[model samples]
Target: MADTNKQSSEKKEYHKKATGNALTTVKNHSKENDLKLYGSCFCPFVQRVWISLEVKQIPYQYIEVDPYKKPDLLLQINPRGLVPALRHGDWGCYESTVLMEYLEDLSEGQSLLPPQPKTRAHSRLWSDHINRHIIPSFYRFLQEQDQQKQVTLADELKTEIGKIVDVADPTGPFFLGAGISFVDIQMAPWVVRLNRVLKPYRGWPEPEPDSRWAKWVKAIEENEHVRATTSTDELYLDSYERYAENRPNTSQVANSVNSGRGLP
Candidate 1:
């Protein structure tokens, strides 16, 4: 019991705040507002909503929360004390994908989803694919400690990514072509982590230069909004070290992966 408590305390202390560009973004949005985003810089799920807000030019306050500590205020808003919770006036919403959709419903500055129903549905299908397949595979690959198992998991991750690549637009950049859409923003943070965190720690290889995957990666890397919401690569490496080592972690995603269950 003492060891578990100590580990929890250490995790909370280790992940206190965001740094670099993300820190700048947090400062910019520090002022009080009706729209508030409770998030952590170390979280990719939070990044998804953050990117959506930035891309759509939504006016919002950024409130950093240590999810593991489960502050009273955050628990009131999300109950689960999850980051990526959105508070609008008196109402509150959680879940990264749901928050993105809620922001879209506001009909704010820009539209992340397309106008046509068919295209929007298509976009949603792929986004769900990402949530269900790509992300789970990523964590499984990241948290697997055995080298032989890692090899198999790496291939599974690659296969899932390749499925997306195959369905994406044939031309240069973005999932649905020229303009950035919800799908691109949805998957951007993980793409960043794939290169920054997974490569060095898990021996994940970079996509070939001329490959479609590389093109998509280049687009995500060059996105101004994505860059604004991301912290330095070093911070990401430090944040994910526990997952790489397959050590006990309190994160919902890590727990799900470790237990052979679906991501929460």
Candidate 2:
């Protein structure tokens, strides 16, 4: 009882400090309806959770956390002080991927994980590849300013993309044979952001229309779940363009590339 009261007090304080940001709690939440998310839209990790919530049709309260400001409430819930944390009453959990799985287990909508155990394991493997290889390669390609360095990083990124291509199901659309699954959701943000965000700076050509990679991207873009969670291309550019300014040794390149785009 005391612990529950402490949690309630913390929530009240968090709401008081984070007022005007989107925040809510379920008055009568069952297992399905009792979800609250804390994170920012600018974060891809957060977007993953948002996509799952929208896809699963789970009702949730969203509170946009500013990592720079470091809300006490957020810190109290997640000691690591990371975004993409989930809270259900007094219980809280962090880590975007774990939260995605948690939502999958809790919701009764379309199954995000593959039906077969081996296939599900494969999906998890691909998701690991995305987090380990694709995301880092993407960051390197984007933040690099030197032309020679950019070329090297671009080649590395393509190599990673080629691995994805090799592993992809060549039949038609999504990765897990038929419908969208964990791997697709995991990779969606970076795939959608890649060409739109990096092409100008990296000078890397977009994937050819007939390429498997292109087809994969098209399928995800056309997904209702992805579309609902994604921000506009303009917004992505604007947000990341400012982000580029913060990276050391990339200011000149960021300024030069982002100048004509007129994002304010």
- Report the number of the highest-TM-score candidate: 1
Q: Relative to the true structure, how large is the alpha-carbon lDDT of every model?
A: 0.90, 0.69
| lDDT for each residue of candidate 2 in 75-155, tens digit (9 for 90 to 100) | 987886777788887899988888889888875787799778987888888888887777777776676667787789788
- Mind sharing the TM-score for model 2? 0.78
* Model 1 bad stretches (over 4 Å): 1-14
Residue 62 error for model 1, in Å?
0.3
Candidate number achieving the greatest lDDT relative to the actual structure:
1
Model 2 segments more than 4 A misplaced: 1-33, 246-264
* Candidate 1 displacement at residue 189 in angstroms: 0.8
Cα-based lDDT at residue 96, candidate 2: 83
Candidate 1 clash pair list? none
lDDT of 1 by residue, 4-72 (tens): 898867662235688889899999999999999999989999999999999988899999988888998
RMSD of each: 2.9, 11.8
Cα RMSD for candidate 2? 11.8
Model 1's alpha-carbon lDDT is 0.90
Q: How close is candidate 1 to the true structure, as a TM-score?
A: 0.94
lDDT for model 2: 0.69
